[model samples]
Target: MAIPPHAQHDTHATTRRGGWPTRRISVTALLCALSFIMTFVEIPIFPPAPWLEYDPSGIVAFVAALAFGPGTGAIVVVLPWVLKTLFSFNVWGHLMAIVANLALILPAALVARRVRGTRGLVVGMVVGGLVSLVASILCNLVVTPLYTAVGIADVIAMIVPILLPFNLIKIILNCVVTGLVQRPLSQALSA
Candidate 1:
């Protein structure tokens, strides 16, 4: 049997050279560990909801997604989340956090893979930021009441004043920081 021309050409996009699967698995594990550590290093930047702290764990998954692919990036997000939940026992929070992380990562990685180069990355991040912000808002609106004693009215009230700004700041921070580091990291990984 013969491989198609397009399939042969695109194989390199999906697979790296030299022990490719092993390399992805190892890096995914490393990224997951880093993300787990990051959860502990958060700052209470949002005063309206001080409990809604800021952490850069998303960056680990984003970088992994940018380098290896979405599946590996997902492993980075999920494994840490599962382990963290085992200790914290916050199942709903963990589930929602996964959704939030994927909102940014999926779009950015998909765009980067499809478009290529710095331009693709920038466009992807911008789109991902918007998507993440919206997803965060929607998730908070829907899921906040389930976790908290607060009513839907109170949740709605907090959306603009609290959740919106909090998510905006977080998404922008992720975008800028990840954008700054992604190129160098990609080069390093490829090398």
Candidate 2:
């Protein structure tokens, strides 16, 4: 099948010496910058865990993945935290965010790449959202205790009451926001 218009390659774009095209690199950088800036603009959702904040950087990464493919999207996912780690030295949370965002974007980007159209997008997002939820639960099980004073049992207890719902809400919001902007972003990039 022909590639969707949104997936169409930029004909004039140069990938000199077989490297990534300038446009792709620029877009990835822009997305990473946006993600980095977004980290500071978080909102606390659960009162019990006032420290856990929701940042929509994942949505920007997801849009990059959807527009450029999952592998490139994965780079976009990691770049912000990699940059942040340089200054903050907070490895655990950044690592968790990397895993969570990758899990969130990959399923949707891979599926959408194969299955075109609106239905495909919705299916991909739903599958990706579920993947994010489960991966986050597993990641929290392992990573939370290492970083926080809380134990595994406490983390487990918080899963159903806090983590599960919070992750769901986060992914859903990312999905909605990405769905709104990805098409236009893709089209503009392709142009």
Candidate 3:
């Protein structure tokens, strides 16, 4: 089926921003699959918080963003999440992961496209990452309490510390890895 004119126009506009072809799609898919695999390579930081395990999956999506852009990066983000919920239906964790990822990945993608150097990139992303982290936390803290009048205070206390650093790490790692990889990949992409 033919894409509608408006859709075609939008795609062409995005292409004008930065273009990619079939090989780029293949490269992005490879990275997305690698990200899903990396989810299994988790380190449990603690015990009772079974819902919380550290993973480096975000880095791969960041690579996709750097290689392509935000639209392509979003494609990979959903894939791993769907695969995870299929394997084990932890609805709460999966939902949280999805929300948290949307909260985190986008700004990082925008930043990834513009980042220049390792150290400078690190500082800039950390600042931007903090903005995302705080916004999400405040939204959660305010809204979560409204619904559950119980020890919402305790929930915030428990979650905020863990969440803040996790987000910070996610952005920093994504930015650093994207910065390191993008230049070399550009050579392949330009060809």
Each candidate's number of clashing pairs is 0, 0, 0
lDDT (C-alpha, whole model) for all candidates? 0.82, 0.85, 0.62
- Per-residue lDDT of model 1, residues 39-60, tens digit only: 7677888887899888899998
Cα error, residue 37 of model 1, in Å, equals 0.9
How far is 113's C-alpha from truth in model 2 (Å)?
0.7
By summed lDDT, the worst window of 10 consecutive residues in model 2 runs over 10-19
Better of 1 and 2 by lDDT: 2
TM-score of 3: 0.66
Task: Please list the residue runs of candidate 2 whose C-alpha ends up more than 4 Å from where it truly belongs after superposition.
Answer: 1-18
Taking the tens digit of each residue's C-alpha lDDT, what string does model 3 give over 43-160? 6554545545767776666556555667776766767877887887765455555555555556655665577556434654565467657765665565555545636677678674
For every candidate in turn, the CA RMSD to the true structure comes to: 4.2, 4.2, 6.1
In model 1, which residue pairs have backbone atoms overlapping below 3 Å?
Answer: none
Q: How many backbone clashes does candidate 3 have?
A: 0
Query: Across residues 31-97, which tens digit of lDDT does each residue of candidate 2 receive?
Result: 8899999876789876766778888889888988998899888988898889989978889988988
Q: What is the lDDT of candidate 1?
A: 0.82
Off by over 4 Å in 1: 1-20
